[model samples]
Target: KEIMQWIDSENSKAKVQSSIHNFTDMCWKKCVTKDITSNMLDTTESNCMTNCLQRFLDTNINVVKLIQAAQK
Candidate 1:
């Protein structure tokens, strides 16, 4: 039982990491339109990525809440 719980915990961590990677890739492509000349992101690109990440998180939270409400 302990091993099963540990496996579940690891799987959850992996899923979260995968979600973060996917979100980063999607946001980067959507926000970064110009060529990558420098290591730092410009103001517009930075704001775009921030907004994109916020929107994704907000949407995810809302979905989870709705599912929880339905289950209850």
Candidate 2:
């Protein structure tokens, strides 16, 4: 039982890490408009990254709201 619990805990951690990685990759792809020419990001690229994160979070919120409404 303890071994199974350990496995479950590890699996949950892995899933969360994978999700974070996926989100970061998706956001970067959506935001980065040009090739990385230098170490510092340009203004547009920076703003795009911020916008991407905001939209992503907004979408998650909307989905959760829809689910809650459906449950009720």
Candidate 3:
């Protein structure tokens, strides 16, 4: 039971991390818009990526809260 629970937890973590990576890749493409082969991202690019990730997580949290409230 414990091993199965641990595997499930790890699988969930991996899925979330994979989703975040995919989202970051998308956000990067949106911000870059060209020469994705470029190595280093500029300050604006970096900031945009950060904001994109933060807002994505924030939106998810807000939605979860709204769903919980509706359920209650």
Candidate 4:
């Protein structure tokens, strides 16, 4: 049982990492329209990425809440 729990924890971590990677790729494509001239993001790109991440988190939270409610 402990080994199974550890495996599940690892799988969840991997899935979270994969989701973050995919979200970063999507936000980059949507926000970055110009060539990479600087090491840091400008205000527009930064805001866009922030908003994208916020929306993603919000959606995930709502889904989780809904799932929990349904399960209960």
The residue ranges of model 3 lying beyond 4 angstroms of the native Cα positions read 34-37
Per-residue lDDT of 21 in model 3: 86
lDDT of each: 0.96, 0.86, 0.88, 0.96
Residue clash pairs of candidate 3: none
List, residue by residue over 23-58, the lDDT tens digit for candidate 2. 778878887768788898688878887787778889
Cα lDDT tens digits for candidate 1, 1-72: 999999999999999999889999999999998989999999999999999999999999999999999999
TM-score of each: 0.75, 0.65, 0.72, 0.75
RMSD of each: 2.7, 2.6, 2.3, 3.2
Candidates arranged by lDDT, highest first: 1, 4, 3, 2
lDDT of 2: 0.86
Which residue pairs overlap in candidate 2's backbone? Answer: none
Model 1 poorest 10 in a row by lDDT: 33-42
Question: Taking the tens digit of each residue's C-alpha lDDT, what string does model 4 give over 1-72?
Answer: 999999999999999999989999999999999999999999999999989989989999999999999999
lDDT of 3 at 26: 81
Off by over 4 Å in 2: 40-51
Local error of candidate 1 at 48, Å? 1.4
Model 3 quality (TM-score): 0.72
Report how far off residue 42 is in candidate 2 (Å). Answer: 5.4
- lDDT: the better of candidates 2 and 4: 4
